[model samples]
Target chain A: MSSKHIVVIPGDGIGAEITAEALRVSQSAAKKCGFSFTHESKQAGGAAIDAYGVPLPEDTIEACRKADGVLLGAVGGPKWDNVAPELRAEKAILGLRKSLGLYANLRPIKVFPALAAQSPLKPEIVSEVDILIVRELNGGIYYGARQEAVIVNEVEQAWDREGYSRPEIERILRLACRSAIGRKGKVTSVDKANVLATSRLWRKVANEVAADFTQVEINHMYVDNCAMQLVLNPGSFDVLVTGNLFGDILSDEAAVLSGSIGLLPSASLGDGTGLYEPIHGSAPDIAGLGLANPLGTILSAAMMFRYSLGSEQVAAMIEAAVDQVLADGYRTPDIYQQGLTKVSTEEMGQQVINRLK
Target chain B: MSSKHIVVIPGDGIGAEITAEALRVSQSAAKKCGFSFTHESKQAGGAAIDAYGVPLPEDTIEACRKADGVLLGAVGGPKWDNVAPELRAEKAILGLRKSLGLYANLRPIKVFPALAAQSPLKPEIVSEVDILIVRELNGGIYYGARQEAVIVNEVEQAWDREGYSRPEIERILRLACRSAIGRKGKVTSVDKANVLATSRLWRKVANEVAADFTQVEINHMYVDNCAMQLVLNPGSFDVLVTGNLFGDILSDEAAVLSGSIGLLPSASLGDGTGLYEPIHGSAPDIAGLGLANPLGTILSAAMMFRYSLGSEQVAAMIEAAVDQVLADGYRTPDIYQQGLTKVSTEEMGQQVINRLK
Candidate 1:
């Protein structure tokens, strides 16, 4: 079988420290499963700016286009804060998503049985929680047409238009349904139809799309109730789909649900290509100290194998290895406990690799 | 001294049960504090619909406008569900708010020390939590200019504008600051300034407003961050002010923070009149069962005294009495404990009245 091609862009700060370990762990998982892997490193963000005077050089975009999947570590730090605001370190991901035509962002929130005690919710509430959130990323308020401050009726006023055409809402709902197909087969489309016109339109589209997926049970809830449920009854939700603004808020709230934001992995997918990465940001102060956590990135590799590569067995192997290591009380500095064994980034990666069998 | 005029609208269902106890509790507090009270009962919701053929009758609005403050119980039930959706039981409050021009909606979330065990969050996290959320109810997305669904380029689309004129934002921020003045002297103005033009305008206006209120410390946070902070650090916030859309979502999230949604109260104030009520809805299932909780409505009466009737001492007296009753292990059915003494709605009201001295 031909080796799967993956693009590695360890953009800045601790990006380099963690991506190396993630790559090692990916290779170990591939070896244990009798599969071959091929990958290439590319310059982006601050590193690309130092070499080519731009955060996202054309060559980097072209390289990602040629690969089957893209794996990114954290991006942005104080050192590049003075760059032109448009060319700042964070734009690399934004530019990549637009250039790759990625629209749906998948963030899975699962309270690991071994680490359920880390969450703020009572143990019983977090015990049975596994949620997949499909957020429509390319449209809505963030990408809406806007006008700067203008005098209206002798008062300073500014507004941004929020709109979602049928195509945008349909694709996202379809993606959410697809995500729920192999799980509990439940999808909850969240909106503010009681207030916003955009939400009413979104809800109409959702109901229309839901009719085609008869096997999946669908529920529509107001965004406010959904936010409360995330805290009050998080175990009740399966797959949640929403517009960009609500998604941004609810996803962050869900990230906080785990109490392990630094160890979470996310995937962005379009109709054609997929991109996987860790959810944390670059830690400039400890960039070279080998103190950065690599589990998020290693898990991102697992996501790549399951989503972009045709290997569910390899993905499951990598994920099980991570679970095995955590069960042994092997902890990184970010998630260290008083009695647990603390390991550096490389050591933690090695522990998982050793458990891959 | 002249007696304060109070209009009582026992709207429907549990609304009648709770408001009767609330009115009784108010009379007890007034008697203990040597203040005279003059009150009138008016019909609204389904009651008004049966008598005057409208959800919000003109006589009810006229009475509320002439009074010093309004004490309302819950509204809406299945009885009026078949009414024209626009003329349903729930529209009474909406009609009242628009007619009364009540722009500032106040919801206080304070986890009572005696009942902190009711919260889903660990007791340690809920121990020091107290928050006042002031939502601008008249403007923002709910009342903005909107275009209904229209096909453009063969795809259906709809949009709602989100705009805040200077005066609208200023008055709400001023109200929030005033709310903080008597409490912790700190305010947090939540917005989404980084992405939305309306939020940027809100942030700029918030900063300008902060300069005028030198005695109180004000901080600005993005809406997404505020949502997470509500769960992660509820105790750190004193007062939160935001536009209607964000507020509608965040205030509900804050309400969940206390784990006693059934025991929460709210107030809506304009320049001329004030309206007070509990945060929960009329549970038709428990309409006249004597099982409804009355503390929330009774507490709303306390807010009425402090905010509209100019009786902070009496308000404090009423609040402390309720707290004492709870501490003594007196529980209503909604909040009953395994071994605590259970009481009917009016019995609990009498318990609070007995503690008023």
Candidate 2:
């Protein structure tokens, strides 16, 4: 079998520290499982903005495009807050996405049975909750034609264009349905169709896509109701598909339901290679403290294995290894309980690797 | 004193039945307080759409405008799902808001001690939760200038103008801050200023307005993080103020944490009279079954007294009556526990009135 090449972009602050351990863990897992892996490191985000005069260097984007899979640590820090919007750390991620045409953002929120009590929701209600949010990333108000006038002459009017093409909506729905078919055979398309015309098109195209997936059950819910249901009856959802803005809000809430963003991983993909990353941002405050949680980054590697490399067995083994480590009481400071010992990022990585062995 | 005139718009489905009981309860309270209430009935929503060509009849709007306050008994039903968007039942509620210029939509979510165990959140987490959400309604994407393609085969691009004038943002923030000072003495302004230019203007104006109210501590949170924090640690919040769309989602989620939307009430106010209503939609499915919860509507009447008519004492009396009735172990089907006695909508309303006497 050909060796899989992975591009690692540990963008800023804690990102740099965490990505090292994530790579170490991945390397150890591949060795234990008898698979060949090759990894290379690149710089992006705030650090890139400082060094190369651009947050997303052309070479970095080219490297990501050519790699079989990409693993990214978190990005952005207050140190770079003064940077212009396009040149900021977050813009690098957005630039990579647009340049690579990465439209589908997949986020899985699951309540691990062992840690269910940590949920804000009652244990009985949240124990079995597992939801996959498929967000369309390339379109919506985020990338709309936005104009803002800050001058103190007349009243300032800021307008954001929210438009979606039939093809964009159709492709996203099709991708979501296929993902649903692979899991629980159910999908809930969320939109504000009751108000917005873009949502009307979204609902229409989603219905047409649903007709193609005869075996999968498709449902529609207004975005507001879906947000409520996510809180009150989280177990009822399987796969939720929505646009960029709603997805941003819903996914963040869903991430916290698991009790820690450190345990959540995400993937961004479209027609080409997938980019995997943890959902948490870089913590410049605790960068050198060695206290950053590395599990999210590790799990992102697991997603990269499955989605980019198409190695289901390898991915499952990586997941099982992490689960076993957690089940054995390895706790990072963020998720550390009353009696468990708090472990550093490198130690956590070592513990997971030991479990894999 | 002139008898306060309340225009009642019991729009459709269970609206009429529930509003009748809520009115009876309010009248009983008014009699005991040595005040009088005069109720004027009007047609609106889907029923109005069927009887008259318009969802909000001009006569109904005029009647509500002339009254001291308007009491809406929920709107929308599946019977009007196929109707044109403008003629839909929700249009009536929206029309009322725009016609009345009801810019501030205030929804208070509290997990009453009596209903603590009914919450989906852990009892320990939500036992003392009380939060107020002030949503800007008259402006933003909901009522913004929306341009849609009139015909197909054109480069169909739609744009929604989300404009909030300096004055509009300041007035709402000032009102919200004052309410916060009256209760928790803290205010959190939620926005997406990190992305949306309109939100930056909101942030700037809200900060400026907050300076005038030094007694109230003011802070800001991004909308997505705010949504997550609401679920993770709801008790940490006091009064949250946000734009129209974000407020709609967060308030709905907050409603869910109270366990049943059946017991929550809301108020929409601006330049003219305030509009009081329950947080629930007209449930056509359970209509005429006597299962609809009337507490929300009754509580809405209390909000009408406090916000519109400035009758704080009357509002407190209504709230006290509700507390006493719930303390007596009476439960609606939605909040029914194994051992509690289940009461119908009218029966529950009567119990509240009797307890007040």
Candidate 3:
């Protein structure tokens, strides 16, 4: 058995309850797959602010850097709303990503067959949706230099730069191409090539990178069209990749198509240790009440196993168990339908554990 | 009766057919409301390329500049696909917008009750969607300074600047607020203030401008959240205002929510002549077959009455007639239903004309 280590950050609100369930489920699934891993709980977000006066402590960053992967149960809440800009709870994730050198943000938007009715789209339109959005995290307009509102030529204006380097686009595209392998083998590289210079360069680099992956077929789409297509024909996509700003918009748009955001997980990856988390924010309203959903966190753990722990078997086992659990009609309060069995946060985790093969 | 002179550009493919129907409908509507308008036929797009060797001829620009307003049919077809970048058929619209100083692009996305089933979204969710998107057109990243791919610090990179002036943001927000006055009296200013400098400035200016419209209620939304909400609860929005890039995207996304792009109309307005057109492209395959839908063009004409021609009564009459015609089960090929009366493009135009009171 290969032994690996991980850091867990149960940041705030329902983070504690959900991360506990996810940790237990991860242990059970790893045990079933004959895999062994150790995890240490760390402080970050509001919890870290309360403990160390900073949202992201140096100690936590050091631990995450040394670990194989990190599992975060979200950050930020109204409790930390008044914090200084640099010390805000949400800065923890940004700091962690920067420190860990995490570049690509992978968001898998899949509509579970059992939950298809929950979608805002017609059931037929969303039932077959299984899209993987590979968003380049550290580049593009989000991280580019910006100027605040200032007087220029007698007019007050603010500006931001949207830039992409060949290496940045190449790496993210390579990851997207690799991600498409063993899946649908289709990658849609989205940009605004006709209008933006960075997008034009991105398209060129995308073509160059995709050439190295023979099995992966790639096509380019404008960001605006892609936004419409995600709602119109989401199933037509396999791996959708774009820069930070477009990805931030499209992934959130795609996430809502599932209609159950609490069940979606996200993974941030780079050359070093990856970070995993639920797409939803910390629900301070349901903190410690066991009313929150733990599946997103558990799915994050599954992604951790696949991307960082080198245990695709364990990841598959966990994911299949989750699918079976939902198929069996066990639901948390967040996803509860009238005729289904409504389970609590812990009960949902145990249900998945019992079904793990 | 006051008389107004307008220029009509029947650009390419179905442009001639649709514009002719729209022109006839507009004249009849105006006549019913005791108003009169004179229109001159002008060539642009591929037609201009054929006639004057330029997609946007100096004559067309001068004519449009002097006219009260401009009504355009769809532009571009495969025949002009290989034209030089600057001479492309699509350049005609861009050139006209620039030359005429049309800076605001308004796309009204309203789901016709009779065609609600055609939406990819559930009928209940889409049945009440009526949104007007006010997009800033003349500025933002689309028109920003850019650097093509070049070696920077030994790595090839490309960049584009996204800038917004107080005047630019203020005018668009003012337009949105004014647009909301008669309808819901609500405006949702969408931006990415949490990320970009331009968005922060946009939000600030939106607040300042909206303060001037005391009757119009306004709120701010992150662009990503707005994208999700447009699908999850589209009926929640009244007038959504945003910058150039965000508008181009959200408008198209909202257009698909109607599921009948052929029936959607758009208006670009500024200090001078407003440009009105349908959101759909010219369908060359069905160009001369009378199979194209003309409701979008007619609706665009209706907007011309409201915004440029300064006859709200004529605009309302044209719009109500359109609504009643659709309710009476008259369908064009693009929005046809099995049980409804499928009419030719010309027949559909005639139906609206008959319904005009």
A210: Cα error in model 1, Å: 1.9
TM-score of chain A of each: 0.97, 0.94, 0.99
TM-score of each candidate?
0.98, 0.93, 0.99
Task: Give the DockQ-based CAPRI class for model 1.
Answer: high
If the candidates were sorted by their DockQ against the true structure, best first, what order would they fall in?
Answer: 3, 1, 2
In terms of lDDT, which candidate is strongest?
3
**DockQ of all candidate complexes:** 0.80, 0.62, 0.90
Q: Give the clashing pairs for model 3.
A: none
Model 2 chain B TM at 0.94
* lDDT tens digits by residue: candidate 1, A1-357: 657888999999999988898899988888878888799999888888888888999998999988898999988888889999888888899999999999999898888887878887777878888899899999998888877778987889888888888899999999998788988999999999987889999998898888899888888999999999999999999999999999999998888788787778899999666888998888888898888889899888888898888788888998899889989998888888889899998899999999997
Q: Tens-digit lDDT track for model 3 on B19-138?
A: 999999999999888999899999999989988999999999999999999999988999999988999999999999999998899999999998899999999999999999999999
Off by over 4 Å in 1: none
A41-84: candidate 2 lDDT, tens digit per residue: 89899989888989999999999888888899977899889977
The per-residue C-alpha lDDT of model 1 at residue A349 equals 91
DockQ-based CAPRI category assigned to the predicted complex of candidate 2: medium
Highest-TM-score candidate? 3
Q: List, residue by residue over A2-35, the lDDT tens digit for candidate 3.
A: 9999999999999998899889999998998889
Which structure is stronger by TM-score: 2 or 3?
3
